[model samples]
Target: MEAALSRLEARVLVYVMEHVPAAVGGRAVEIALDPDGPPAVFASAPLAPSPGAAVVFTLGRSGRRVVATLTDADPVIVGALLARVERAAPAGDPVRILPLAEPALVDAGRAGVALLPPSAGRWFPDLPDAIRFDAALVQVSMAVFLSPQELADAQAHGPAALLGAFGRGERDLIRFGARPR
Candidate 1:
């Protein structure tokens, strides 16, 4: 679909590309997420590509976990992203890369494992279940996270109408790395 990489996330993806093996290919850098924005450097080589369509990388739980996913794109990117993610991640923080052929099977509230085919997007073990969205909304929510009121308005207005509201809110949180106080 559209270019989903933020400025900081794109920098991390580029770092992963630089360190990953040639076999990983250019597509190995899909979507990258970091709660703290771009880091000074990324550490790691590369890993095997995923077997799904698109791939996702999310940083959450106060940077305690890094979640990566493969869906609707080159599997190589997923592998490469995971490798760099693990290296760059802090000690004890979990990193998972799952393969999702359909991006519709992911559940709310899980950690340390990547979901595969039929799963929609990656999972951040630290996030609450109340925030998770279904397949359709997950895609949109990635770009933004909706407020409770906004979500209710969308729900009442139409099912698909507010689909992107939650995603937008989510994106804001991920991009900025936390909720405003």
Candidate 2:
């Protein structure tokens, strides 16, 4: 049944919609993962204030799903990042680093991707709703692409330290590839 198939994804989608009003009833674009594989449906919406700020997230993947807030919503780049997630994410591991060095990311100057647990009250505006989602035990992560040097820094100092650097600059988390200020 379609309901059964969407059980987990549906809940997460609901949480996204509730927090991201701009994404409510927004267009859902499906990017094919393979010639015969199920596509990843990205729920996308443009944020206000910043003309180019937008958020795109997957709603079809089971267990771990990826979300990113970027300067712009480029499907091609997002798709590439999602493909890397599919290939690199290890089972039972909450954190993942996906190596990516391509022309698409040249503008951002990021050579790798870090998938980290979304900070409470950062991605989800409603703490109560986020708490409820936590009860479900489904994991939704923020995808922040890092430069080679930054990736090495993370390796040396650890992901927590990297997150601390990002946290120091609140907006850095919302803007992918942004170096901590």
Q: Name the top lDDT candidate.
A: 2
Question: Model 1, range 26-111, lDDT digits (tens) per residue?
Answer: 43233334556533222222233523223344322213233343233333433333434444443231212322222211221111
Worst 10 residues of 1 by lDDT: 135-144
Worst 10 residues of 2 by lDDT: 124-133
**Model 2 lDDT per residue over 1-181, tens place:** 0122256666766667566535333445656656776665556666544455566666536345445444454644664565446445633455666677666775677777777656622554431312234545544566777778878877777777666765665536554544457
Error of 1 at 151 (Å): 36
Q: List candidate 1 segments past 4 Å from native.
A: 28-181
lDDT, residue 179, candidate 1? 19
CA lDDT of every candidate: 0.31, 0.57
Which whole-number lDDT from 0 to 100 does residue 93 have in model 1? 15
Q: Give the clashing pairs for model 2.
A: none
